[model samples]
Target: MNYEDLFIQYQNLEKSLKDKTKLLAKLEKAISKEMEGGDISRCITDTAVMKSVSAEVTSLLQEIESLVSSFDGKEYIESGDFVSQMLEQCAENGVDVTGSSPNFEMFPNKVRIDVENQDIYLDRKKVACLRPVVLVQAIKKGQEKLLKASFNANKFASELIVAYDLALADLGKNPGTDLYLQKLYNYMVPMSRFRKDYDLQSYAFDLARLYAVGSSVEIKDGRKIQWGTSRDGKKGIRILDGNGREEFLATIRLF
Candidate 1:
């Protein structure tokens, strides 16, 4: 090779070495930070809807789980439309059953209880559309339990407002159907993780995996731990406790 060619080759080699060195340094720094215990990593955006949705789903799932644990699915049907009956009882007792819903397919039969303003639609009518009458009956029993519980009623009402609005938004836009699906799936996906005690980011990933809603998370130091979401502007989700550990507010996404 010519002397000039040799020098050019040497220069290229040098550049490659420098690039490799830089990447190595970055990897080392990341490893060091990881070893030293960096702040909790958040995997999602800090949106009010996201947080609210997560909370709602987790709470509902928890209720369903509790019911499942108690009944094992066999007792309710044997008892005959227990949930629907209970809902009727609530109506007779004059309790508000507005917006309380049951996953319809989970039941083998469907029992319709007349509620003011909104008819209780099960999972079959709502999403999966598998209207099993028995399962529907079980769902009625479950929903009746929910309606009777003051705590469940409050949470269900709040979720109903959000769900209805989101569903309406979905129904309105034809071209934006994908966006609506993303939003709905985003809310539904994180629910299982939240129910299982995973933090917001983990739940967010679940949404991404199921619904393909992608997002980035960032954290900064402040007087209080704060969370922000894509939909809302600069809303805080955390506060620094006296002990300095960040406490979550309405939402939490790790650093």
Candidate 2:
């Protein structure tokens, strides 16, 4: 694709990802609502909604897999366009090609890359991996709904927090839940910051105001966090950090 065409395609992909994300959010909300009123945890794992979510999730996973595997190079991570070629490069570079997400333990012969911590492991041991780049993209595609709930600066902030707390509590006793909770928190930090800074009060009156306008936060210098508008008149939210770009903790859509 030409530069313009590629750009357009990229944008289109983003939009498609966003749509899938909204659907996932709605599904999650349905599950959460059902669980909140009563105990449906057992039913949730096999519910139609959950199955649909899993299917959509699988599709999103494929997209992320495609995008991440498109690059294969020893010097630069973005070197190849084919997954097989990337695997060959990994073999050539002595970088172990481990099994990936949804099955971190199935393949024993290769190193394992854990999506929860964005880290790599060799035979159940930690290995040096600067993986925040791939992680940011993957999380963005897989957990859009959580990101939205986390980033909401409006009326849903309190409710979102409650739902998140419930999820953590419910999953706290379960080992499998911890990993997912960790991933959820990693993506929610930026969103939490937006809610905390953007809206001061939490009373009914204040909540009404908070609900009226939702904004985003951006980080500058990776330390300083700020909110407001962009140069092109896109009104949402942003933040700045003083320490420069930190690893991608989370991403919140401005629109």
Candidate 3:
């Protein structure tokens, strides 16, 4: 059977299993209430609905176990060869691949395949299994997530208002032409490296991409949020784009 097809089947079965388990729980609860009527001889076989639901739950569990056993898969250890293989396989399957060596990323959505660590990560949550089919599943999931992860310029601009407001408050709440963009960035994002949080880094990366793509930020309050360049001796947030060059955004003004 096709691995992807089998995986999809397995997922569907798992979902069905959950539904059956819930029905089984309801049956058990109902039985407990019935038993409270003082019938000592009553058991799980006492009613047709109770017996039917319990039997279905048992059959589902067995089928799931059998399906799992049929997947004769093994761990895919990371090596130089594994990286090359993934580069080809992932792209062939329509997931864009980038980065290099032990650490690389793929996406129609953001997923990190850490070859050295034998893991796949989305939003810093690790997929622990090193099974090759699991990687395929991850690629498919990345594609699905792409549909949901589109950049929302309006939401981002709204957050900018919050960050800008906090920066203004920090600087004594006086009327100013602009808030230093670096100050706003510091308020809005955490120092990921020091905090040991990859989610914060991911968030900062998304923000930097906005600058790279020249995305517009607008406030709904009839105010304008504008990006300004930093001149000599002015502090700025350097958006380092992995190719050895950087971009800067120094000031933001709301009027």
Candidate 4:
């Protein structure tokens, strides 16, 4: 064919292909709408089927929650002795201890609780034997109750309040630590910015735990330690190596 004729034919074919693609897209869209009961945005399913499935799922969830809630708090407390109680408490709190060693770790409220060599560690520091019990109680009371209790007590509550205030003051500073503050606020101020009632003991427990987790601390020879804030305003664990160089270990975040 002549060049002009060939070029015209090529243009016509391209146009035809484009038209066909458009038609195919329109057809597919129509089919999808039909399958989706006239709504292309939704999935194809019988309304009755969806309702039945939802009801079943809701029922199962309720049953599961009921079974879980029925558990007496004493099951872990009365398991065996102090060590056994600690282990049981860890298990009940979803902390796994089935590994090869006696060291076990759990993340509740994004805070790490490590049971190493049968000693409980919160924020990597060895804590009292009653730490687990207090932790569990704080969790049960909810975050706000824990925060209020923590703030009310004269313990390490000031640090958290200061952090929270600093976060609020800047609104863009230390975004990493903001997660921890948000978690506390979500628990303490669910609807409004003010809630007066709180559990004192639970607050104290939560304060100690948060302080241990969110504060910057030094690990010396992996034994004796000093807890304080760094000059940079970032909180994390710092371990000193043999060369006396400080190494960043990990930052505690709200999980």
Q: For candidate 3, write residues 1-255 as lDDT tens digits.
A: 244555787888889888877877876777787789766456445566767877887888888789877764323334344455556667566555556754554432345666555566664668665444457567668555644578776787778778787777777766545877655766776464644443433444555655544535555786765677654324754444434244455777776
Q: What TM-score goes with each of the models?
A: 0.17, 0.24, 0.43, 0.22
The sequence of per-residue lDDT tens digits that candidate 1 reaches over residues 3-98 is 233345556555655554555555455555655674224212223334554555456556545543543233332333445554555455433233
Q: After superposition, how far is residue 217 of candidate 3 from its true place, in Å?
A: 5.8
Minimum summed lDDT over a 10-residue window in model 4 is located at 217-226
What's the lDDT for all of these models? 0.37, 0.39, 0.61, 0.41
How would you order the candidates by TM-score, starting with the best?
3, 2, 4, 1
Report RMSD (Å) for each prediction in the order shown.
30.9, 23.8, 10.4, 23.2
Whole-model lDDT, model 2: 0.39
The clash tally of candidate 2 reads 17
Query: Which portions of model 3 miss their true places by more than 4 Å?
Result: 1-78, 107-122, 131-137, 149-152, 168-186, 189-198, 201-218, 225-255
Better of 1 and 4 by TM-score: 4
Q: lDDT at 135 for candidate 3?
A: 72
**Residue 203 deviation, candidate 3, in Å?**
2.7
Sorted by lDDT (best first), the order is 3, 4, 2, 1
lDDT of 3: 0.61
| Highest lDDT model number | 3
